[model samples]
Target: MRNHSGHDQADHEGHGGAQPGGLSVSEHGYTLEFDSTILTAGVQPVSFRVIGPDGQAVTEFLSEHDRELHFIAVRRDTAGFQHVHPVMDEKGTWSVELALEPGDWRFFTDIHPVGHDGTMTLGIDVAVAGPYDPRPLPEATGIAHIGEYTVALDGELLPGEPSELTLTVSRNGRPVADLQPYLAAYGHLVALRVGDLGYLHVHPEGEPGDGATAPGPGIAFMAVAPTAGTYRLYLDFQHNDVVRTAEFTVRTATAAPKHAERHHGHHAHH
Candidate 1:
């Protein structure tokens, strides 16, 4: 079945199968191993590698959107989300610098190996040492204000159906008409379910200069809700050579009843 965004049920999980990513460090024959599971606060060095089925580090990978691996780090309480690309060494060890706060964090690695069947998104958790305090998730809202831009999310997430979600961008009450491309698209969207931080695949409806897609004012995305629950969405967009992220908390509606199926099965026992 499709979710409100018209995407397949599997899309809410990860690609290539029904299993979800970021739930475990090892999944579907590939393992996400890190040099250290414990890190310190501040801008620090973080390194990890992907172990293939042969029990060795995978050094070669097919680039996706100009990057071999896309690393996403977020605090456990739905805070501090960063989407970045780490540099891989000759030994397949990937390292990147992240400004981390004191708390538990989860890392998601999205990659595609040259010989692998499809893209793999692996998840692992790391601990940040020091005093820790968790932040409560923000209440559900359609509008997200960050920096000089204000983004208003318009759409409802319905379970087991395809839904169209549009995010409108404005600055100081004026519509933004020129949104620069970021990561090969006008915007990059990442969604995670609230409870488990389950990764959801949110697809952009169109790309920049795609003949019908406008660069500004509104960016459309399509996704399907796998279930009824609250989800956090982060949208990254570039404008005037700088990239910024807008986050939103959304809840999906319960799945619609299948009246037709019920009726079909009720054959009046004649």
Candidate 2:
């Protein structure tokens, strides 16, 4: 596993010393320029573009995860998460329709420019004008139910450490073994820290055709929490040719002290 700190440091430097992903609208020399930042509450079309350093909308991009770009939309309170791909025009403007409610929304674009070193996630906030009533975040849990499917999470997140997370999918108490490949994998996981919505786009441990990886009920991923905090996880899996997302609220576990023997000795003496 790659060290979180080291990876973050490299990202910081590579993105012209900007803050982490999903925290800024502009990074390095690219900017997320939206056509409008205010919209009506409901399903509406939104348009935006990634303006490159040359002051033009970027038209050339390298595909990542079977697409040139990935778009994510979530409310400010970490509710109403939607992962959708936008259709980019020849002029570099991308458009997509989103089912937005009466609240503040954050839109993130995960993209890799042709000459960029790595992928970059850029975020912008939009306001849907209406009577906004923010809902409290759901309590931390290991299980989430989506329609007829139930996803059970079996793993613990340790602060600043790479942890293995396995999510098993079942429908009506039966394991789903004939899972279809989505984005070249059995699943795609996106982790966002609660307060700041720090974005982490994580892929599954193994590919779909790999001999060791099973297509069945369990999808594994290695995720690193930047700190000890509450985070919201979204898992997009495909079955029966339809993509569905399972959401979970997870809190990082604090690591134990390393000098336990010395501390016990002091207490015994006392």
Report every candidate's CA lDDT. 0.80, 0.82
Task: State the lDDT of candidate 1 residue by residue for 1-270, as single tens digits.
Answer: 222223444544562124445677887789999999999999998999999999999999987656788899999999999998899999999999999999999999987787876676789999999998899999999999987899999987766555678999999989999999876678877888788888764547666667988898898876666667898999998888999999999999664435534655786543
lDDT of 2 at 203: 75
TM-score of each: 0.88, 0.88
Clashes of 2: 0
Question: Which pairs of residues collide in candidate 2?
Answer: none
Cα RMSD (angstroms) for every candidate in the order listed: 4.2, 5.2
Counting clashing residue pairs in each candidate, in order, gives 13, 0
Positional deviation of residue 102's Cα in model 2 after best superposition, in angstroms: 1.0
- In angstroms, what RMSD does candidate 1 have relative to the true structure? 4.2
| Candidate 2 minimal-lDDT segment of 10 residues | 1-10
